[model samples]
Target: MSSHVYVAFDLGAESGRAVAGIYDGQKLELKTLHRFPNTPLRLPDALTWNVLRQYAEILQGIALAV
Candidate 1:
């Protein structure tokens, strides 16, 4: 049988990461491809996430993974 491979992008409140996984018949092995910060910006009035920047980070992570 052929091997199973998987790629995952895990986004969290503090950061994001790209992971690659290999699956055997009974177990799975995972490896990290890239990780970037996602800390929100805190201002006097509010806290916000820079979505545009985060998107750019995602693109970067994808590029690095490839």
Candidate 2:
């Protein structure tokens, strides 16, 4: 039998998370690898999300999945 791993990123209204899915011949399993608050960055003129931070966290999650 062979198995494969897949990573998924979930960004919601209040939070973000990285999840891993493992599949073999039959069933699939999901596991949360990392999570972070989806707080926006307040700028002088506008509000923005911390995209770089999210990317870095996603990499961390992928490492965990590996």
Candidate 3:
């Protein structure tokens, strides 16, 4: 049997996480690969979501997947 892998990212109000789904010939499984805090970045002009940091964390999760 062979296995397939999939990754998903979830960004929420308080936090963000990366999840992995593994499917074999007959079964599927889910696991949380990484998690990070989602906070607003306070810039001089306006507040924004820390997207760059989130992106980095997502990459980290992908690295761990394989």
Which ten residues in a row are the worst by lDDT in model 2?
53-62
TM-score of 2: 0.90
Please give the TM-score that candidate 1 achieves against the real structure. 0.65
Q: Clash number for model 3?
A: 0
What TM-score would candidate 3 get against the native? 0.90
Each model's C-alpha lDDT? 0.82, 0.87, 0.91
Residue-wise lDDT of candidate 3 within 1-66, one digit each (tens)?
Answer: 889999999999789999999999788899999998989899999989998988898899999898
Query: Model 1 — which ten-residue stretch has the worst lDDT?
Result: 57-66
lDDT of 2 by residue, 1-66 (tens): 999999999988679899999999799999888998888878999989888877887788888888
RMSD of 2: 1.0
Question: By lDDT, highest first, what's the ranking?
Answer: 3, 2, 1
**Top lDDT hit:** 3
List candidate 1 segments past 4 Å from native: 1-5, 22-28
Q: For residues 1-66, what per-residue lDDT tens digits would candidate 1 score against the true structure?
A: 566877788888998888878787788898888888888988899999878888888787667656
User: Looking at candidate 2, what is the lDDT of residue 57?
Assistant: 76
Q: Of models 1 and 2, which has the larger lDDT?
A: 2
